[model samples]
Target chain A: MKRRAFLLSAGGAAAGMVLLPQLARAEAGRIDWYTGSDQNILDFWTNIVQPKFEAANPGITLNLVDAGDNAGLQAIGDRAVAAMASSADPQADIFESFDPRLPKGAIEAGLYVNIKEAGLSNYSKINPLAFDGDYSVPYRGSQVLLAYDTTKLDPANAPKTFADLIAWIKANPGQFIYNRPDKGGSGGNFVRRAIYEVNGNDTSKFTVDNYSAEAADAALKPAWDLLMDLAPSLFDGGAYTAGNTPSLQLLSQSAVTMIPAWSDQALQAISTGVLPETTGLVQLSDLGLPGGFSRSVILANGVNKDAALKLADFLLTEEIQSAVLTELGGFPGVAWDYVSPELRDKYKDVIPTTIPVFPGGDWEKAINDGWYRNVAPNVVRE
Target chain B: MIIWPILSAIGRTLWLPGADGVSRFSLETYVFFFSDQYSINNLMVTLWTTGVCALLLLPICLPIALYLRFAKGRLAAYVQGLAIFPMFVPSIILSYAIIRVLGPNGTVDLLFNSVGLPKIRSPYLTPWGPVIGLVWDNIPLTVLILLSGLGAVSDQSVEAARDVGARRWAVLWHIILPRITNSILVAISFTVLGIFSAFTLPYVLGPAAPEMMGPFMQRTFRDLNDPTNAITQAVISFAFCIVFGLFYVRSVAKNRKT
Candidate 1:
């Protein structure tokens, strides 16, 4: 009798071991999100969004992975692309990109799931431009603007046109600054706008999808000439800052009067006391500034497609969009008409015009290379 | 376990099928890395910065190590504490602190102006900025290594040299330095590797065009989305480290034999 009882107990224990993992898998489903955004965005998702999401849907978990910006996105992209090539799952179900162009290549490689077909409730509220071939969902936007200290520079005398800006830079030597183009997009935006201004203020000629070296040379010759003319008049005799933050730091310390900066970042810095209250931002009237949106793409082979779609849709909700404006100081991913009046009024003057998307990968490479080779050598003093 | 992943990554760069669907072993990545002007420029910059850092650190570290070894008092302890304190501070905070103190019209400039001298522009925006930060960050480790080497030297040996009518400088030149040659090489190897693979200091302080290999490789892999070229850059960096590592090994082996 004792031997028979021991054998039955041993068989039951073995069965329990075999069934445990299956039970756990049935009980809990998890969605992994990869992002290269800053701390504020990370906090909003972790501290605010995650708990609310989990509460609404039981037995589901959301994992937020903070990757480093720009460069971090690339690392995640490479890994994800590699995993997809081997018919395996990537590290995350959702991938967040700092630049839309960063994910354009991956999307073309068919790495992302098409969330448009998921019939998300909040999809209609987003700006049409935010959709990238039905694979991406933009969450926030950053617009490039001329940020200046009001205590030093008269707002009325601020440059309105590219020509006016160049003259102002020359007149106030060592007071105006822009970062190197290859370092940050604000500087690249400044350079691209200059190229637009030189081509008879017609952005159409340069807005095509393909890159033509001959066409670029002809269109950008005058822009290079303009940059060469402005070189000697830059801050510290043409030695520019390395990145966006340094430029803002220089402005705050009264080292420089003005710099090209992201509108949302400038405001956020001011709110955090990094920039003084007297700091003001303005978009050029004659020469439009560049603006782009940050987007999220769901991987094609994600483990929990339903959860990923739900989270993406949730990020586009009015409540989250408002939080993006107030908490993170980001432009809403949805149309401005959907935003509160107070927030809309605050950014009315600095609202960015829709500029052309970056032409393509080859054009981008050429632009960065051209700036380093032809422009940086002449402008950089030491 | 670590070696397994590194070898796999390298193998992927050398043999993995590319986007064009060709899977064969090739030196194409190396050819691409060497042929690119930007990559070549970054490599040169990395070497230059590392070489300068090693040269700058030796004189500075040697004296501090010697002083700590010879001096006996609370002042030596305080100095040692000060040297080690910077290591406790995070590199990012240290970098920001350095920038604030050395930026245009910053603390240094303010001091110069207050003293009635012409206000000098800060070099923090230039290549020299990163060099200074690198030295500041690595001085503690370099000093620690040299101090360990100094411990191996005996005061009796120095006294014997003095009794033999050797001068202070001669004693230091012959007895002290020869005993610590291995230590100096070790310190130099650390500085070289630290500066070559540095990201935060150079990213915050150095110019954008001629970046260090760490940041350059990151940008190539992440921003440019070219993993093969990035791995190629990594392989080159590894080659440099290996050369210095070999020197370290040889010095250690020689010391053991002696």
Candidate 2:
């Protein structure tokens, strides 16, 4: 009886070894795209990008999974980082929206593919925004700009410089407000732009790696003085909005003449009649406000690495970029010169010649915290 | 589970790495918190909000709780439901709803404007914003707690007070108030702690500067990416909540002992 049981166990173990590889092979042909986008963008992928890409490249199934929220995407990113460290199967081929930094050394460890070096057809067209590194390829860009109601304020009279913007706020008391810097990016960039304006408009002076207490004092104090001087003219006499959307709501309600808001959100709001037809958006020509981009990254170790590359390349194609604009009301990753003439013409007025970029890490934290500490509530450094 | 997270958080606050490799326990976080003017402002705002919310919650909730506890029939049921309505709604939705109903050019403004009145100043982004929203939010739970405490009061106790020719106010003051002391303590303790720990309501409705500790900790942790200071801010908030929590622990223990 013992000999028979041992033989049976050995047979079962042999079968398990044979079935595991078969199960692994069955998943080999499929590529999974993980995203942290909301339902609408996920719908764009499920209903639009999936079918189109699948039809273009037959036999390779594209599995687009909505990873819920940003933290969800970050979880997958951490998992990929772990897998890369351990040289294990990542189980994910493409991360549609992902964090570029994780597990302390994901980017330096090269856990993600460098799409530009990957030699995709649309490699040159991708926006040059390696927020961490070339760990992710950007597919859409959004700039923070001044959103003003044309009925209340003339489009031609929009603030063109940081000085002009600050003057306008004081000149028109209780007619302008941005969100708290810590609350929203529109206000954050607005604060960042102001910091640049005061410190000789030289953004080159600040870097993610080189922030020091001395540098913060020299660069930030002037910005605080400027903001503190301009505080009384804010909405409700030194009131700021809660967030980007609330700033827009203030504009729509005609409570404020102008507000800082994302280009995509303002355009969508105006198109949807949430903001009136008279609302206009303009970027600062003098050292333009910093912007952000939604990007995709590929797992370095995946069975379907080649298929994932194809999808990443496909996402950057002008066709998908236009779809991103039309369907999601987002700025295309491809430059205006690369897009169709009609698409270019429609969005030409709002496009920045070059999107001003700011390094995050320590500098961003200091500016945000400083805005809270020194700018808004009237705290001053001795 | 609860103790582990709390202990871990408390440990994170105490972790101070020296210039060398060795780790040591220090009050560096506490010192930074106390010395930093912004952090002190946040602590003051948190304390202010707690005090105002606790004080205001009683006046608003006590009358309704009294009505719900003493009154009868369909009106009492409707009043009870109406009192605790904010509990069912999520705080995010409540903040948005509060904005629409009470914000500038909102329903109140529009209604007033239709009658040709001037637009009123909104409390939407002011310090009062959180206080108003918090009071609205806390009503349901405060009422529920007070009602449970009121339930323990016997009808015969009130009748005995009445037999001694005690008026309504006298009976409520001498008989009802004394019996439900533990309940009021519990309610205030719970509300104060909850108010101190509240995030969504304050973030949505409160001022940008001098924000409560919840937003302060979040901005420090997330926006500032200063986990040490964020954890420090949290430790400060936890300390505040613990002060409020003691009242509850004491109340529960005293009742248990009895």
Residue runs of model 2 more than 4 Å from their true location after superposition: A1-29, A36-40, A66-92, A97-138, A295-306, A379-382, B1-15, B159-165, B256-258
Local accuracy by lDDT, each model? 0.80, 0.83
TM-score of chain A of each: 0.79, 0.85
User: Could you list the CA RMSD of all candidates, in the order they appear?
Assistant: 6.9, 5.3
C-alpha lDDT of candidate 1 relative to the true structure: 0.80
What CAPRI class is candidate 2? medium
Question: What TM-score does model 1 score on chain A?
Answer: 0.79
TM-score result, candidate 2: 0.86
lDDT of 1 by residue, B19-58 (tens): 8998889888888778977778888988988988889999
The TM-scores that each candidate's chain B achieves against the reference are 0.95, 0.95
- Candidate 2: residue A136 lDDT (0-100): 75
lDDT of candidate 1 over A1-382, digit per residue (tens): 9999999999999999999744532112788777787777788788777887788778778878887776787777777788778976665677765433444477678777766776889888887756566778888877788999899888888887778888889999989888877678778788888887787877667654646888778877788788878877988776667788888888988899999998778888988999998987888887567767878877766677778888888888777787777777777788877788887897776765563445546666667667765665544474
Clashing pairs in 2: none
Clashing pairs in 1: none
